[model samples]
Target chain A: ADAAAGRAKAVQCQACHGLDGISKLPDAPNLAGQNEDYLVKALHDFKTGERKNELMSTVVKPLSDADIANLAAFYHSLKP
Target chain B: ADAAAGRAKAVQCQACHGLDGISKLPDAPNLAGQNEDYLVKALHDFKTGERKNELMSTVVKPLSDADIANLAAFYHSLKP
Candidate 1:
């Protein structure tokens, strides 16, 4: 829930989704200013195999609930 | 940016993204409560082929700027 903590956890996500959440890859949706709840749900879906993207599935597999929440918070705090 | 007009225009979107913006299909991201600017940008990206997804590209090809804005407003107005 802490934005600062989320920032720290966001390093892993910076390659595809930029540090500012503006998506470096065209295939990756920009995360900046996205709804926190939606981001959390999306991450959970990716982790659970409900939403299947090869890269997302692999990336989210190691994330815990707290990590997912932090990542969502970090992304949602940005300006689009 | 009329949410009412957007609601009417959303009939086309209802199949994959539900009438309320929750996704009916697993591959579709939920649009409810998403940032309006982000949604507009996403639609443009799909239209321009900057982002490539067969279905999205086809869906957005016929949408005008006003239609995109209205759709964004309507979806952003929803609860996540």
Candidate 2:
């Protein structure tokens, strides 16, 4: 998974999670400098409904594993 | 539960989460201005190990429901 590609694909996430991985919205967690392992697990949980969130579930449903990995890598690369 | 009391109780959380509910550590999420319902639910999840975190699980273990509510109210009162 390319971090650069992830940055490009992360445009959809920018409304709540900032382009730099900081969150702009309430209830949205900042993604910068978070553990990549944790991020990937969270995306999987959201996609599978293990962690239930209306917006997150919908957003993660269409993401492939590579997409999830790339996003996690991109976010993890930023400063917290 | 008093938001004031929650603020007092939140001192223990200040190491990772700031007094204002912003997080200082990577992988530690900011709590300010989050949904009250979501906060309570997250506390419950942590306590039950549904959302597992070594620190959160231990932190929430001793809290009563009222304590959770107070903490939620206190964090929610802040600006994100």
Candidate 3:
């Protein structure tokens, strides 16, 4: 999985999650310095229906395992 | 907006995003250290349809303006 591709993928996430992943919106959580294990679990939870958000599950469902890995790596690569 | 309350709200975001908003998962992101202004814009984008994420919009739509502010503050209060 390419980190660059993951960065590109984050464009869609910029709205609520922001370009850095940490949200500035009220109630929205920041993603900038979160734990990687936590992120993977969350993504997996969304995709696997463990989580209860319809929209998130939809977004994550389409992502391949490789895509998820890349995304995770992209975020983790930054300084927290 | 109460930063402490906002921190509580972020519990759901712990995974993938991590507790501090930096992801440890491969390909995820570090939300702990981003621009506050950027974060605010991202959340607004999601809630307002300026962005194209179904999940994020859904998640952000449920929050009030105050809630967003609090959440943003919580993340911003951290060492990003």
Q: What are the root-mean-square deviations of the candidates from the true structure over C-alphas?
A: 7.6, 4.5, 8.5
Query: What interface RMSD does each of the candidate structures achieve?
Result: 7.9, 4.9, 9.0
Candidates arranged by DockQ, highest first: 2, 3, 1
- Residue B21 of model 1 has an lDDT of 84
Q: Comparing candidate 2 with candidate 3, which one achieves the higher lDDT?
A: 2
lDDT of 3 by residue, B1-80 (tens): 68898788778657755777655455444556455555676677678775545556777888887777777667667765
The candidate, 1 or 3, that scores higher on TM-score is: 1
| Residue-by-residue lDDT tens digits, candidate 1, A4-76 | 7889988989998889887776457667766687688879978987656688899999999999999988988
Which digits, one per residue and each the tens of the lDDT, describe model 1 over residues B12-32?
Answer: 999988998877865576777
Q: Which residue pairs come into collision in candidate 1?
A: none
Over the stretch B1-80, how does candidate 2's per-residue lDDT look in tens digits?
Answer: 58898898899999987888777875666677656766888898899887777889999999999999999899878875
Q: By how many angstroms RMSD does model 3 differ from the true structure?
A: 8.5
lDDT string for model 3 (A8-78, tens) is: 88787778777776564654556654555556766886787755465677788788887787776676565
- Candidate 3 ranges beyond 4 A from true positions: B1-76
Cα error of candidate 2 at position B67, Å: 0.5
